[model samples]
Target: MISSPERGGTVSTPTLRQILRDQLAPADPRILCGHDRLDVPVRWVHSSEIYEIGPLLTGGELLLTTGLGLRGLDGGTRKHYVHDLAERGVAAVAFEVGRTFDEVPDEMVRAGSAARLPIIELRSVVPFIDVCRAVNTSIAAREVDELRMRALLDDALHDDLAAGAGVAPMLGHLADLLDAPVVLVTAAGALVSAHGVDDDSAAWRVVDRAVAEVPVRSRGRSLARLVVGERAGAPTVPYAEALLRAAAGPVSVGLTRAGVRGSALAARLVEDLVDGRPLRRADLETRLAGAGVTVGGPSVLVPLAAEAPDPRMADAAVAAAAFDSMARSIVDATVYALVSVPVGGPGDVDPVERVASGLARSTGLGRTTIVVGDPVGIDRSRPGADASRTLTDSLRRCARQLGLAASAVSPAGAGRRVHTAREMLVDEAIGTLEPSVRAELSALAAPLAAHDERASTELVRTLAVHLAHGCSATRSAEVLHIGRQSLYQRLERIRVVLGFDPTEPSVYASMMVALRSLAAGA
Candidate 1:
């Protein structure tokens, strides 16, 4: 049986019994069969005499018809006709018998009974239009009631936002209004907030049975999902869907605001350690303590580059990787996390390895490169900031290496692996050239850059590829997806622009370094 809400809340549509007793009482309506389904909500009223009208209906309509269409049909056909209407989810079939038949057909009655579809007969004089008007009026009234409830819910959410009470109170208010539990979970399935339920309780099972789910998105990428429990009765799916749709925007904004606040604080901690500012050990310890990070311990600076098509998704993946770490920050496309772990103890895995393992298992970032700095003591003697800077530089170099490997024809060595800062120091030095040297290098590529700006040519990129592949024209052509002749022509163009042969070993080496430096933002 369907149960409806009280008057103050959204009202459900009028049921067949309610329509018969309240609206069609003057017509002396009586149930001919299927008395058990009187509570089925009548979505609308449709008047038709078409024998095969099932396909025309969108379901949940009370069908009103005279017996004229059944006059020539056999009993089996008549039964099939009623069965078709029932299968189409007609709330009830009201038949007026006097014009076409002396009494209700037993075949239709038997079919309605078998299908448990409500069948009614209008015995008194009543116009079909009158019944349609009454049902439509009732449906409109229910819609108005739902609109009022929705308005009230929207107001409550806005008030909560203005009052600075956060999303929990708004979710609680929604839970009370709908009389169902609500849960907000991150894209990683981490619980952000819940109302009227405990995660461990049986009531939370209702979340698993959510009738509506709305995505909470930020920067055009989904960050979380809001799940609303189904109401016990009264055709609540539509109401639930509407409520979640309205709430999703505010919820996403709230989550983003919270993240920004947290990220700002984390960024401060990271900046203090990597910005080359002199930070006394005592002052650093005090700030770390305030940020809930323990200092004077073995800490590994882990730099990670995760691949994501969208920047927001990359941020989210990095955030997930930083969970439970001492401190973390997103600098450009890379994420750095300072993780603390036991040093050199039995069964003590490398801190960077441990964190990378966790990130690999949790984040679905397709190709990632992790650079681990040597473990350092965060004390007065050791320069923690300098070490962090070195780790960051190493991460940048590894990222460039990974990018180059991806663009190569032979990418057999592009698999993800952890590298130490020492292993990448030479590339880091070359990429992080002094400002005066970088200016000179940029001048060398000025002609190609100007050409790219004017004609959108690939001269600079072609030169970079040729140099990166050991000046092998064939390999560069294969990587660039161009013929060797086209590659030679581009090389000739570069030679004219630079006033030198690019394939010469001395010139190739210098130009390659300059291009690599430019690519690394030197």
Candidate 2:
């Protein structure tokens, strides 16, 4: 399921005939072979060499071939050859009428049609290169559109995170750009999000059918499907699929940042519809409710951090490698980690926190400090912005209280450490204790809370770690990324303030207790 990023999603390109039809006119473009009228986009043309083409064409191409070089060309030879192509799932067979095969033989056509294979017979002498160019040009144009759409989507989606414009409005923005209606459907083919479609429209039906066709699959369960709507007879552009796939990563990213923006927006719109407002909510509810989730309810917000800080690493490569290793490990475990820059750094605009939160619930982490706030009530919908603000404030306060540089919020059950740490931090005395030691020994170490600042905490913790490592000053210096002289100065500062040498064996026992006490208090 997880391929290289480049090959992650299939790029559907317009077929040769389809390209010609789109470029020329939507006239009576006859189907000689395959589903002629079907809008099969040409991903790319395959080489004439049989071995070379086999891998490139994956069950969908309007193969335009003139039986030029078949190893054997006897009675049933060509017929069997065409049959093989049909079995390979080529969308259509476009045989040039004037070539060696001349007109497509009735037997070949009959055999192909019997296999439900689309066949096209080129009446006029169109160059094979012309067909290739047509398809290529169409693909290039569509690629340009796709790229433009992705860029515009990223720009529009930024607001969803920053301004808290729930899922509906965000999807609406996408629909507007594509000039098509949008329907956010649930797994059982229910329409939860409807933008640009009104009641008594055939567009809704198309959306419903499409949703049934493309079931949602995320985190080992199918929860919802996204269906794009167009007019009654409008072509079912794979453009929508392209839009969905391309938009998914960033949308997921934004949703993580904003926390339940999609579900919250849907809830608000549902309430509006249920209350006899202008929107049509019941129809949407009927569609989405079948997905096995209540149309209205409370949901907790959670965030997953891709990597934790390793004080041992000094270089960027090591830090990045750590994050990548953690991300790969976690994503495989049904969790998606969003990497972020460490807090308190200048201009660290990492999207890790937001992305983690958006993909939080899917990760199935119970709850912790990483996941802040409460399960927002959805029985009667309110603006998502309010809930988001509450969550942000809660997280900010927790971070300040805990002195944590970075963290991720998961559901309460999964992120219990965060909850415990936050609970510990709320104690007034614990907040002033040496950061790590006090946090760990919050209750017992309250009496030894000599200096409250971070510098004091670091000095004590550094001295403790060094002493614990068999008093190897060199190893301690390496871990702290400081010189021996600096380490000594830090130890001296600790001795002066705390009245005990960290290096002394007799003082070690007392220091351990003090550190543990400070941690419990925190």
* Among all candidates shown, the one with the greatest TM-score: 1
Cα lDDT for residue 99, model 2?
56
Tens-digit lDDT track of model 1 for 304-381: 443232223444555665556456554432344555554656788876667656665656454334454555455456
Error of 2 at 8 (Å): 30
User: What C-alpha lDDT values do all the predictions have?
Assistant: 0.65, 0.46
Q: Where in model 1 is the C-alpha error above 4 Å?
A: 1-10, 25-36, 76-80, 113-116, 151-166, 172-241, 248-342, 345-522
Each model's Cα RMSD: 19.9, 23.8
Clashes of 2: 57
lDDT of 2 by residue, 1-522 (tens): 111112223334665555547532322235654454356545654325242243456776666665565434554765676677666777666665555665667777777777777666656665566666766676677677677766777677676656755456666766765556666543322334566677524546756455222434444544445566653344444456766765554444432232221234333432232222432334433433432234343323222322111111111211232331111111110111112223335664333343333334333332222312222222235433343333234433433332231221111121232232232333434346567656445433333344546344565456546755667889888877889998887777767765556567766655554553444333
- In model 2, the Cα lDDT at residue 198 comes to 71
